[model samples]
Target: MDEQALIPDSQQGDLNAFNRLVLAYQDLAFNIAYRMLGDEARAEECTQEAFFSAYRHLGSYRGGSFKAWVLRMVTNACYDELRRRKRRPVIPLEPLNDTDEEIESPAWLASSDPSPEEVVHLKELDTAIDHCLSTLLPDFRSVVILVDVQNMEYEEVSSILKSPLGTIKSRLARARQKMRDCLQGFEELLPSEYRHEQEGK
Candidate 1:
């Protein structure tokens, strides 16, 4: 059955259809949680909690984009997790191992002859991006994550964020500009080609 038909049926307590929906969106939901929380364990917990919360509130979902609805739920769960963490402080950074420095480029940017120095530089850039993302207010970060990292269009981000399209565009533009500024500090560490290209732009 199509996703639209399955949603209402699932809302009415069809475990099979709900499970199918879970299968379709679990990775997307978990990745969002992981990105937001920046902790694998906490992200997993948030993902599980979000799915359960969604199941409990399934009846409240009144048609239209089920993916967007579930994503909203996931985002809410991540927000709640952040709030809870604020109430009870914990050590901030995760411990890293040497192997973690290995670079695996995104498919869109992958190249065959990347060097070890290049790998480390790209990894540092990734870390800088994560740091800059963490600095953003949650609302702004959510828009960036949804539109940039998750590759959602402006309209989908508007629907997911429940905001005006103009707001979404403005927030995304500001977020990207902020990230670019944050990355500028690391220009010396970047590949010379990248540095020259960025300087030209």
Candidate 2:
């Protein structure tokens, strides 16, 4: 069934309908939370919280993009997490596995067909991008992630962030520029071939 149909059922207290919506957008919710917070564990928590909040507030949801509505809830949860982290900062120790081996990169970075060199290069690039994303102010980061990464339109992003369209565009531009600068400075860490490829672009 279309998610639109699911929404009304969900609002009417149908847990199965709501769960279908959850299955549809769970990746999106978790991805946005992750890109915003840069932590897998926290992102998972935020996604769950957003869904709970959404379920409770479904009665207030008038028509329009249900995906955007869900995004707004996820974004709010991330903002809350960011504020809490600021209030109680803690050092993050290196992650270790059951055998006590330090985990160099997240297992999610592994793929079935990539060569070892390809995997390492991809991980390095991924790290640089995440670092650049983390450096952005929350407002700028949200706009960029929603627009560039999530491929949202300006109007939808404006709705999600509750910012003016012009403001959303402006922040996305600045955020992209900052990411470029950060990554260019990080060229030393990437493979030389990848650096050349970027330069050619």
Candidate 3:
């Protein structure tokens, strides 16, 4: 199915067409929200809200990447949630550690069938990654999640973020650097292969 056609149809009040588009991108939207907020239930709520917001504003979408357009709504929803969280501060169970560095070629981005040992290791690594992600400021976190975690290109990220290309690049660069530095402290927790995956890069 052509995604472009569905966009115009959705704009014209085609609920069925919009539903198809939703089915296609819901996982992406949810994952983004989950990554942004770090809470499953809140992520679900934000994703649903974003889709509703997207539907209401469908007519305002000029032709471009529909995925990015949908994602803009998702990010906005996530931003709103984060702002709410700020207003209701809570005591931290863990502390944040800040640092800097970049990883353009992350080995973890590779897909594969995992062995039992690999599976266990991956769970630990994921937790470490999530912890590091949670420490980042929302803007930096969004850039990293979209570019590195979501494997989106900078142009699409800029579109989703509604920022200048240069600004996106800078934020992503800083975010990656921060992640690289933060993950170094978890070198013992992560596998040898995972730690060295981006050596050349």
Candidate 4:
């Protein structure tokens, strides 16, 4: 059944309908969480929490983009997680080798069966992008992540953020500019196409 059909069913206490909706949206929600929080474990936690909150508040949802509504919920969860992180910080401890040097290829951070070259490239690009994203203010970061990373339209982003169109436009523009500036420092690590584009600019 379609989402409109599913929404009402879900609102009427249909767990099956809601589970279908969850299957449809779990990836998007988890990706939003990961981009915002930058950790797979925490993102998973936020995604589960967001879904629970959404199911509880499903009745409050009026006619609009259901995807946007779900995204907004996940974003709010990320914000809450961030606040919690501030109140109680936890230090990460990486295993050290005999020389007291951090292991370069820890099993936990490894990808599944990627070619060595591909793994290196992916790691470099991910690190570069994550570093740039980390520098942005949360509002600016959210707009950019929703638009560029999540491939959301301006209208959907405006709805998710509850910001005016003009505000969205301005923030998106500033965020893109900031990202471009930040990325330039890692031009060599970027893919050739992106490196060429940067060089042209």
Best by lDDT: 2
Tell me the number of clashing residue pairs for each predicted model. 0, 0, 1, 0
Identify the runs in model 4 with alpha carbons over 4 angstroms from their true place.
92-123, 197-201
Cα lDDT tens digits, model 4, 1-201, are 499899999999999999999999999899888888888999999999999999989989998899889988999999899889878987557657679999676664343333344344545877767767876778888899999998888999999989998998999999999888777666777779988886788
Who is ahead in TM-score, 1 or 3?
A: 3
Q: Residue pairs in steric clash, candidate 1? A: none
TM-score of each: 0.78, 0.80, 0.79, 0.82
Query: What is the C-alpha local distance difference test score of each model?
Result: 0.80, 0.85, 0.84, 0.84
Question: Cα RMSD (Å) between model 2 and the true structure?
Answer: 7.0
Q: Pick the candidate with the highest TM-score.
A: 4
lDDT tens string, model 1, 1-201? 489888988988899999899899999999888878777899899999988988999989987788999999889999999889889978434434467753343432333333344345556655555656766777888899998889999988888879999999999899888767666666666568879998798
Candidate 4 displacement at residue 103 in angstroms: 11
Which of 3 and 4 is ahead in TM-score?
4
Error of model 2, residue 23, in angstroms: 0.5
lDDT of 2 by residue, 1-201 (tens): 598789989889899999999999999999999999999999999999999999999999999989889999999999999999989986555567679997676544333333444345545666666777887899999998998888989999999998998899899999989887766656767678868988899
Candidate 3 lDDT tens digits, 26-102: 99999999999988999999999999999999989988888988999999999999999999866443322244445
Rank by TM-score, descending? 4, 2, 3, 1
